[model samples]
Target: MAGPSRFVVHVPFTAPDRAEARQYARMLARVLGRLPEVDPAEATVSPEDDQSVHSRLFCDRLLSGGHRCALRAEHEAPCAVVESDR
Candidate 1:
């Protein structure tokens, strides 16, 4: 068995406000959550600072061992940033 799969996804951005940040984080989850092999609920992103956040995605045996490498890279794709004017 390949065991559990872990991938570190980095979400980088400066949110305009708390609401925007929460929405953005939720957006990130929705995208990655669509992946069938991984439990989207387990995937999360926490702000590292004003400029960035780190996302951790979890997958069980459903994910091929090689798939873990792609998780982070795939999540990093260009995503539109939503922020409040404030």
Candidate 2:
């Protein structure tokens, strides 16, 4: 078995405000979350700083392992891995 699969995908970006950041994040998630590898319900977006927002997308290998790897390979920003439940 592949084991329990989960990842906290961090996508960084700058936005004018929380609303805009959320809009942009949602837009990005709309595309990324829609991918077979992503669980949209578990996806979340939050501001890391005044200039950047972080998008966390959880994934399961059974759903889209290939797609997730492809994204990780192509992503410009370094992704953050959630280490624990808390």
Candidate 3:
């Protein structure tokens, strides 16, 4: 069987620091994820200087119904999907 289709989109922007960059990535993912074709859980951030080194912004744990964890990576709480109420 064919594996899942995958593609990469690079969105470059300026950030004061790594921490701020991560914050921006998360925000972007959440916004883009609203689209049916987008998978926010798979979003990752990397510095322009070292594009090879990627840091995940979400927990991305496999969850029920084939969904992935929406919490930030390494989050202390149990993995869960993004609530619509948010």
Candidate 4:
């Protein structure tokens, strides 16, 4: 038996700035997360010129029982799982 294989998909798009780009990435992640195979919490963004460097869009902190935080990165509030509108 083997575990599920994982991979990364790079989506290149132009944004007015880094902040806007991050916002777009987070939005895209949330929408895509509706699918069973998409893990939006693990989404990240990087500049087109320097793809090697990356910035996480979510806090994604490891919680008890193997769960992860669902808040934005560097959030001040306590770690929690945010419910999405279905």
TM-score of each: 0.44, 0.50, 0.82, 0.86
| Model 3 TM-score relative to the real fold | 0.82
Q: Which order, best to worst by TM-score?
A: 4, 3, 2, 1
Runs in model 1 with CA error above 4 Å?
50-86
Model 1 / residue 49 / CA error / Å: 2.8
| Residue runs of model 3 more than 4 Å from their true location after superposition | 1-5, 84-86
lDDT of 3 by residue, 1-86 (tens): 99689798998999999999999999999998888778788899999989999999999888999877889988999899877433
Query: Against the true structure, whose lDDT is highest?
Result: 4
- Would you give me the overall lDDT of model 3? 0.89
Q: Candidate 4 has which clashing residue pairs, if any?
A: none
lDDT of 2 by residue, 3-81 (tens): 7778877778889986677667656755666567765535557767542544543332223333332122224654434
What digit string (tens of lDDT, one per residue) describes model 4 on residues 19-73?
Answer: 9999999989998988888889989999999999899999999998787898888
- What clash pairs does model 3 have? none
lDDT of 1: 0.49
Task: Rank candidates by lDDT, best first.
Answer: 4, 3, 2, 1
Q: Name every residue pair that clashes in candidate 2.
A: none
Estimate the Cα RMSD of every predicted model relative to the unseen true structure: 13.3, 12.4, 2.8, 1.8
lDDT of 4 at 11: 87
